[model samples]
Target: MHIKTKFFGDIELSTEQLWHFPKGIPGFESERKFALLPIEENLMFQVLQSTNDSDIALIVANPYTLVEDYSFDIDDPTIELLDIKQEDDIFVLGVLSLKDPLETSTINLQAPIVFHTSKKVAKQMIINDNKFAVRHIIGSQPSLTKEEA
Candidate 1:
């Protein structure tokens, strides 16, 4: 299956790489299909490109790499909707917004895109009543990082 993407040009994707979002992401209700493409070999970041819209694409990364203590509970409703069977089946990714210097980039932690890697089903779950924000500074939590001499 060939998909036209914003970041990447025409690319071939296997059916297994296509993710289905029944409810779709917030504001992107009509855009349901997305393909996860690795940015570079062994890189932690990936491009979540929408198959339906050429302009709809987001650079995502595992929040764990940026924030080690990051933790959140997935609502039961989303779990059932996505047909998640076990915790190991899930993979979480955060949308990244790159800015000047790149280190100024922020990730949307309040809403995470959770996927059942085996089933190929995913959903963008919105978190409410949480301390996380849509634009949390990545690698900027000075208090959380320590340096050694």
Candidate 2:
């Protein structure tokens, strides 16, 4: 199906892009439907483009890559929502806020989007981890810009 994307603009999206979020995501209650589009080379980050509204999109990435020690338990309710089964079937992604200089971008650890690929189900889960910050700097930018301000 062809849908308008904020980044790619009028592009064709595969049926798999139609990811269903049973109860919808927080703040985006009405925007339950989203399509995962690649940001760049790294598969770690992608754009959670909303089908309902072209402008309503989010830059999401695998928070685990940023915080390797990151760990959280998925409650039964969430499991039922996404129809999650084996742990391997599930994947986690966190929203990111990009700031100037590229290096200033941060990850939203408080809420992570969990996806059940097999079922094509997704959910934005809010975790209660005191150690986890809603916005945390994972690393400085790559080679070209290594100096921190």
After superposition, which runs of candidate 1 have C-alpha atoms over 4 Å from their true positions? 140-149
Compute the lDDT for candidate 2: 0.83
TM-score of each: 0.89, 0.89
lDDT of 2 by residue, 18-126 (tens): 8988787888788878899985555556899988889988998888778878889998889988877789999999999988776778998988889998889899888
Highest lDDT: which candidate? 1
- Candidate 2 ranges beyond 4 A from true positions: 141-149
Cα error, residue 11 of model 2, in Å, equals 0.9
Where is the poorest 10-residue window by lDDT in model 1? Answer: 140-149
